[model samples]
Target: MAYTISDACVSCGACLDSCPVDAIKEGNPYTIEDTCIDCGSCEDTCPAGAISAG
Candidate 1:
């Protein structure tokens, strides 16, 4: 599965810049790529405990 950002997202825009696939978009909670690498960088950069590897 792809990585998903959850409700804990603070919309800090960290994950948006980190996603290589350009999956993380600016939205209510943001979204991930179905082509995710599961690199967990988004999770690493997230301050709100939002992103998860699926």
Candidate 2:
């Protein structure tokens, strides 16, 4: 499963650089595209602790 970003996201863009597959998109809270490889990189890089396994 891909990682999901919750409403708690701060739009800090921290997770963007961490996505190896470039599956994260810019948005209010940021979004995980379908190409997400289920890697935990985004989750680990999220400063607001908003990304979770889905």
Question: Alpha-carbon error at 10 in model 2, in Å?
Answer: 0.5
Q: How close is every model to the real structure, measured as TM-score?
A: 0.80, 0.92
Question: Can you write out model 1's per-residue Cα lDDT over 3-31, one digit (the tens) per residue?
Answer: 78898888889987887777677888887
Instruction: Give the winner by TM-score.
Output: 2
How close to the true structure is residue 2 of candidate 1, measured as C-alpha lDDT?
65
C-alpha RMSD for every candidate: 1.4, 0.8
* Residue 36, candidate 2: alpha-carbon lDDT: 91
Candidate 2 all-Cα RMSD: 0.8
Give the candidate number with the greatest lDDT. Answer: 2
lDDT at 19 for candidate 2? 84
lDDT of each: 0.81, 0.90
Reference-based TM-score, model 1: 0.80
Model 2 TM-score?
0.92
